[model samples]
Target: MYYLPKELFFPSVSLAHSSGIIALGGDLSPERLQLAYKSGIFPWFEDGEPITWWSPNPRMVLFLDELIVSKSMRNILNRNVLKVTFNQNFRDVISNCQEVKREGQNGTWITNDMIEAYCKLHELGIAKSVEVWQDEELVGGLYGVDLGHVFCGESMFSLVSNASKVAFIALVEKLRTENYKLLDCQVYNSHLESLGCREIDREEFIEILKVEKVDS
Candidate 1:
């Protein structure tokens, strides 16, 4: 139960305390944010309270080459019904993700400060987005930080059935082509597992990430 220092990061594997609470009371400044992601920790706090950093015990990740694209999903992908793009209309993508409703939650966890902080990370070339559009309308998308050779996925949303899946598939395929070794899902859910994300121990994650050099 220690507060996160200004622009300082605790050990990713340590995680520091119960509730996966790595640290508390840090500004969402760009430098601190970038350092946090690079160390495999990220900020996750609701509005009004100081930013809380976390690095869970079991880290969720995916190896791009190992992604399981089911025959059914491959067929859906082959259809190419949805158009995907990168870094285009980030604000819309993030806003939509924030507004999307999840089970047992009335609203989003992506606060205004969180949005702006990630936007700054985007401007700095660390954060990236994938957008799905149909007939010039935003239907779904995802965003995250490209830390080292790993992509730390933050959030995703879909307006139409399978739209988010489409966007995610497109992004994963692109990462594979780009030679990115890993995709950090951060947390796990049925949807992510269905998309091929899996949980790895913190030490395993840190080891793999350490071997990966953060591309400038």
Candidate 2:
């Protein structure tokens, strides 16, 4: 239940509440966002709510070597029916993520302020995007904060079947080739699990973040 002060700082992840909210009431400045991701915390709050910082107990992550490309996904990649590009159109990618409807959700956490803030991060090259295009039409994509060794994924959207998956798979392969430590999926979801993401203790995740921050 800690509240952030005006200065740029975050409480230890260990201070997070049972719901993974470490603190509240902070602006989404690029500096704050970068520091948050570097320390394994991310902001996720509904519109009209105080900014919420979360560092979930059982953190979901994808080890680059452990990525699973199912048969169907493999076929899709091999077919090359879709084109995947990085940092090509970040605003469009995140805007689509904000607009795409999800089951059991009435609103988007990717609010306008969030979009503008992350767009600032993109301008600084801290936020990266993977876009999926079909005949030059933007169909699906994903965006996230990219630390040198760890990528903290925010959200993704797909207009056509398997579009987000395509974007994700492409990003994973690229990270693998670049020898990234892991992709931080943040919280767990069945979709991420199917792609070989699994939960590890938050302490473990924190330790990795610490090590990667040093190495980078």
Whole-model lDDT per candidate: 0.83, 0.93
RMSD of 2: 1.5
Give the clash count for each candidate. 1, 0
lDDT of 1 at 39: 75
What stretches of model 2 exceed 4 Å from their correct place? 213-216
State model 1's lDDT. Answer: 0.83
Q: Write the per-residue lDDT of candidate 1 for residues 1-216, one digit (tens) a residue.
A: 767665455655474565667878878888888877777788887877777888886888988876777798778778887889999988889988899897788766799988998899889888899999889999999999987477889998988888888878888888877777789998888888987889988778878777865443
Top TM-score model: 2
Residue pairs in collision within model 2: none
Instruction: For candidate 1, report its TM-score.
Output: 0.93
Error of 2 at 167 (Å): 0.5
- Residue 73's lDDT within candidate 1 is 72
**For residues 1-216, what per-residue lDDT tens digits would candidate 2 score against the true structure?**
989998999999998999898999989999999999999999999999999999999999999888888998899989999999999999999999999999989999999999999999999999999999999999999999999889999999999999999999999998888778899999999999999999999999999888753332
